[model samples]
Target: MPMSFYAQSTVQGTVTDAGTGQPIPGVNIIVQGTSNGSTTDFDGNYSITNVNNGDTLVFSYVGFVPQEIPFTGQGRINIVLQEDAAELEQVVVIGYGTTRKKDLTGSVALITAEDFNTGNNVTPENLVNGRVAGVTINTQGGPAGNSEIRIRGGASLNASNDPLIVVDGLPLNDPRDLSNGSRSILSTINPNDIESFSVLKDASAAAIYGNRGANGVIIITTKRGKKKLQVSLDSNTTVETLTDKVDVFSANEFRSFVQANFPDRVDLLGNANTDWQDEIYQDAFSANHNLSVSGSLLGDILPARVSIGRSDLEGLRKTSKFERTTSSVSLNPRLFNNHLKIDVNANLNFEKNRFAPGVEGAAIVFDPTQPVLDPASPYEGYFEYLNGSGFALNNVPRNPVAQLLQTRQIANVRRYFGNVKFDYQLHFFPDLRAVLNLGVDNSTTKRFEERSTQSATGFNASQGDF
Candidate 1:
């Protein structure tokens, strides 16, 4: 029988930092070109079995340069790892330019999509909340609302304290454009398309924009296509309810308290004891869906992405609802050996807002003894107060339930934003490049407010457009 020469050997070694000379724990030791691997123990000692003379061993650790060594019949081998300066000097996007983190002169925070919060994020700001230090994201108008981002607090007294948003080399709309209350252009952007966020916190990094960057600057880079075709679909739904309800008196408690305090006026109380807070508030629901496809084409890479999203939200108050629909398309193509690149992006958003009247004030002040519906009154089905006459009583505020049903405030907004950018690198000087960008942002808003003749306010219907 022929003698078998194949044999396996165990290799043991310790890994240490070159500069500190301290043992580095959790170092990964892998047999090159094979699935076998091991990790260093607390003493930085790693042992791997089944090692051959020609086999290669790979040692790797975070923040340390990886090293590969051939077994070469050695049973014990010790290795020192040098710190990876390149990993520490990652690239950072600044205003009008990109710089290495080691070369940066000002405070800047970089956040990528991978680091974004996981959940049903409806807006870009929602993805950034609580992730970056010194960045405060204040949700302005409840669920699916716009956010106010302040880096290191407000710097301006009268001017807009919100950061200047630059998306894909184009300046976004004015942050102070809150014409629709708490809705802003940032809410229109699809968070899935975002690749990274770079926040310039100090003047040294944001001074390039002059006055516009006084409060700071947020740079948003959208995702680009990869070398291969890829498709992704994401969908989620969210249910929301008021977390902290006002600690007001319950129906029975309010009735007994009113009877005890105002004994003479006890007759003023209605036959029914109602909970106005419960009647006005409700559980709100919202959902979102996104689909994207990206790929390269021919010699040149052409990536096109289209996304559609919708959100329907019901406020704590009845009849107070906000619905928004957003659709966006981005096309990017590289030509001339990637020297010339063109990008075209278009976004359209439509919103419908129905606001409940007097819910904020009347819902809290309306008499709890009054029933939700007054059957005998002319407004028989609605909750209202009336004397012998059919008209609404003037002494007290309009019934909260009647106010929500009889009065209506509806706002419909249609907004469009489009931009085309061309970047061409000079053939003569490969390092030099020129860019031309043109963008348009337009919005139309129409508002309709009507107070029914039965409403206590008795205001005529009004319509306005902007």
Candidate 2:
């Protein structure tokens, strides 16, 4: 069987200049403000279907004027776009001033905003991963975790090895100040807030920072609101398993090793347990949440921004847990016809670390096979006397329950950091801006551990804070 459809009417159009009456070649004709439309051929003739009575057709041309014509259901329309001569006068912001790309003396690479937003990355280091030629970013192990970046090559050895970090013409706080234990302070920042970042590598480009610029400098510009208020949201959740676990004896192997080696020491031969490493590590989960909103301050009062972030990490160990939360707000005020500016940023972070006895020392030596010191389980120093073959001559098994119940440990660290800046532009060298930057950072960490009377290390406990 054959199916047939028929068109009862046709819609047609021709576009021409109103004054000259000459056909406008290659004109784009579309239904007004809708996805339905078509373009005119070299002869400026176009036709469309599916438009009912009183439907409107829009005609457009790139260089000429643009206009819309209403259809009496016949569907013929024309448009004219005025020549926008002002397009040629556009000036791009380059370096300290505006210049055409052809007129620039230095080589600079620009990354489109679209590419930056659509990238699959959890940190700024990851954002630039394979895109740059001379830059390299390496992650130690986990996702949404710390990354090590090297531009060209490393410069620092021990003290103050990190490259300079500058924001809005203000140098960042010393990298050495943030080295708590072994972690870097730069890891605390969220990559999503960055609008763009530029790295200055050559000596000619980095000389401005003077002595501190030897290692190179990175400039980070955070996002700012535009005319029409816009809001964006970001959230990610990651589940991580241990990439590598310690290789050690299993429960059966450990029992066999103990029984074979400590036959003479019946105490140790009778009470062997699983390797401690197997009991401590576990699958971990982490999550990140971020929200931000930016818009122009009404009538040039001030540009303000607020952001909040939180992270939760739970390790595989049943008794081990770690978590961190942080919040920050920033404001930039322009005064005196944008000649003078003041910027202030405040940030706070709170972390809680809780640990239990399993991962620590001493608790590992006790054997679960031996009778624990519970009231219901009778004391059994007698069975410890039973001799077994392949036992070591002098080895004693410690009580398992005393080792589990006797150890306790906990620690917490709190840190706060902030900075303020004032900048004044010079009249002679308009490109020259002098800035006074001040910052403060402080952290306190406390840890405590206690061992009960049965442990061999009890004598060392009273000595305090090891």
Model 2, 26-112: lDDT tens per residue?
777666767877777787777776565455666666446567666664544444345434432333333243344334344333333
TM-score against native, each model: 0.77, 0.55
Q: Compute the lDDT of residue 303 as modeled in candidate 2.
A: 74
Q: Please report the candidate that would top lDDT against the real structure.
A: 1
lDDT at 153 for candidate 2? 76
Each prediction's RMSD over C-alphas, in Å, is 10.1, 12.8
Local accuracy of candidate 1 as per-residue lDDT tens digits, 197-304: 999999989998888888899998877766677888888777778776666776677778878897888787777778777887778877777777777666347777
Model 1: lowest-lDDT 10 consecutive positions: 457-466
Error of 2 at 272 (Å): 6.2
Q: Give the Å shift of residue 312 in candidate 2.
A: 1.7
lDDT of each: 0.78, 0.55
